[model samples]
Target: MTGLRPAPARVVLRGRTVVPGVVTGEVLVSPETISGWGGIDPATGTITEARHPLAGVCFTGRILVFPGAKGSSGWSGFFQTTRLLGTAPIGMVFAVTTTKVALGAVVTRVPALADLDDDPVAVLRTGDRIRLDATAGVVELLARTEEEP
Candidate 1:
């Protein structure tokens, strides 16, 4: 939906809305959990967790799909910084929700949904475009995409 790309076949997912909103963005899936305080660059939206699989990748403006949060309570703070820096994800789909993830989502003010019928990470692949209607608790995956290498 970003450009002239045609809408592809979609799979509608059901979940519980955390922060209600509608957003369409390229999906960025991560099996690895994020460490908050020292894991990310708020200014650039890049994953900086050392030795992590997604290190150096930028999740900016993407639909960040992951399991849940890790590390300390600093999780919310770092993500909040991302919002202040304008580098937060457009939306998030979590397989499971924690207080940390919920707080972070609200502070970042992004459309977020959790506790899905199926794990979003398993259903969503990186590079798949998703239109998330968090208010309605739906995730629409659009077509196969070139998986990031």
Candidate 2:
């Protein structure tokens, strides 16, 4: 017997550009907001906030998908440290846009988009592959996470 593979699911989303760049990476969805000042460890690129869903999770290299930023104005500085430490996320997608997140995106110097047509936190799942084009304000879902049979 022969079997055929199904085509990969693809979804395109439009959003406001927060940064101008393009990058493709696995999605890391954080339903809640993230704190940059004391919520993350810049050196390790890991979330250090206790009780958070993604506590102890490292966002390095992945495309971080979340609502928005929280905590102090030092948010941008913490993310900047990640960039300096070479542990920053390859891309970022935000559901909400604020001055703090905008500044962080600018300093992180990564492809980032915000205010999408749909809530990315609801649409994207961890492990899904996506291509982010912040310059064009588009997010293309390249592939979905495979389900165990």
- Judged by lDDT, which candidate is best? 2
Q: Estimate each model's TM-score.
A: 0.91, 0.92
Give per-residue CA lDDT, model 2, range 5-74, as digits (tens): 3326558899999999999888889989999998999999999999799999999999999999999999
In each prediction, how many residue pairs overlap at the backbone (N, C-alpha, C within less than 3 A)? 0, 0
Candidate number with greatest TM-score: 2
Q: Lowest-lDDT window of 10 residues in candidate 2?
A: 1-10
- Tens digits of per-residue lDDT, candidate 1, 15-91, equal 99999999987888998888888888899999998888899999999999999999889999999999999899999
Clashing pairs in 1: none
